[model samples]
Target: MKKIILLCLTIVLYNCNGNAQKTAQKTEQKAYKVSKTDSEWKAQLSKMEYYVLRKAGTERPFSSPLNKNYKAGTYVCAACNTPLFKSEHKFDSGTGWPSFDREIKGHVAFGSDNKLGYSRDEEHCATCGGHLGHVFNDGPINTTGKRHCINGVALKFIPKE
Candidate 1:
């Protein structure tokens, strides 16, 4: 009975490890519309941008100038220049990041992220699959009530001409 229980525990542990590895591999294997080699991405983006966009890393809060920007412009994907959020949709969430009440239609993609030990709706640039940030439900009630808390490094602001 002891041997049988040990074998069962070992099998469960192995399966769990395999699943974790598969998840990592799947992330690596997934391709986006604007695929680039690691070298290409590194060459095209700054070190901070590369970390946020390619490695799915988050930037320090209050570190982005766009957080306080209130200009009339469009926020676009830093990687592919895809328009994401318009100036009108931006709001002062006070989260120290650029928060948007909404995204441009068809410009962003959603996925489940469990990195924080809870389910979070992660947003990414649809064109380049760069990690933008996460969305939350606690937003202005007058609007969509969705806060797209994005990494400023993942976007480029194009002021209206």
Candidate 2:
């Protein structure tokens, strides 16, 4: 009985490890409209921007000035300047990052991310494929009820003139 239990545990652990590896191996196969070489991207983006946009890194909560920004304007992709979230959809979710209820139509793309040991809807720039952030269902009930938590380093705030 002990041997059988040990063998079953081993098999289950191995399968779980393999599944995690497989999930990590699934890269973004689709090409973006504004693809660039690593060096080119490094040259165009700041160190922090490169880290968050290219490496799928997250900024510390409440670390982005954009989180407190309430000016009216549009937020564009830091990499390719593609307009993403509008100021109208911006909200304060108090999650320490810029929160939005919606994004510009056809500007942001969604994909499954299991990097944090759970499934999350990851957002990226449709034009440059830059990592933006994650979206959650807990948002303002009167609004779209979607919280688009974005990294400030991944966006450029273009204030309305």
Candidate 3:
């Protein structure tokens, strides 16, 4: 009976090891790709935009001119000018930064952020490997606990007439 129990334990260990190996392989496959060269992106973006998006610098919270903007329009990528968020999706998170409940579908990508040891959602530009900001779960309950903590430098607002 001891030998049978030992065999069962070995089987479970082997299965767990295989699962770990597969997870590692999958992670390697999904590695973030730096699609644009640093110089290329710099040439396309302004100094402030290049710093915030490429260098992962944060803008002053609650200081963005768009934070109080309530007009209907679209916010586009400051670097690539890609449409990212609609004015309709914008909300006051009172967190000092312009917060959005949702993004323009397929414009941003989500990744696991473990920088500070705590796990949080990270947002990145789908076209460029630019760091937009982090997303939090403490947003309005009506819309999913999704807060896109975006940098003011990373976006340019186009007011709708």
Best TM-score among the predictions, by candidate number: 1
Error of 1 at 2 (Å): 6.5
Better of 2 and 3 by lDDT: 2
Global fold similarity of model 1 (TM-score): 0.88
Order the candidates by TM-score, highest first — what do you get? 1, 2, 3
Q: What order do you get sorting by lDDT, best first?
A: 1, 2, 3
Worst 10 residues of 2 by lDDT: 21-30
Better of 2 and 3 by TM-score: 2
Pairs with steric clashes in candidate 2: 62-96
Winner by lDDT = 1
Question: Which residue pairs overlap in candidate 3's backbone?
Answer: 62-96
Model 3 lDDT at residue 121:
83
With a 3 Å backbone cut-off (N, CA, C), the pairs that clash in candidate 1 are none
Name the regions of candidate 3 deviating beyond 4 angstroms: 1-35
User: What is the per-residue lDDT of model 3 for residues 48-91, given as tens digits with 9 covering 90 to 100?
Assistant: 78888988778888878878877899988777677889998899
lDDT of 1 by residue, 102-137 (tens): 999999999888998999999999888999999999
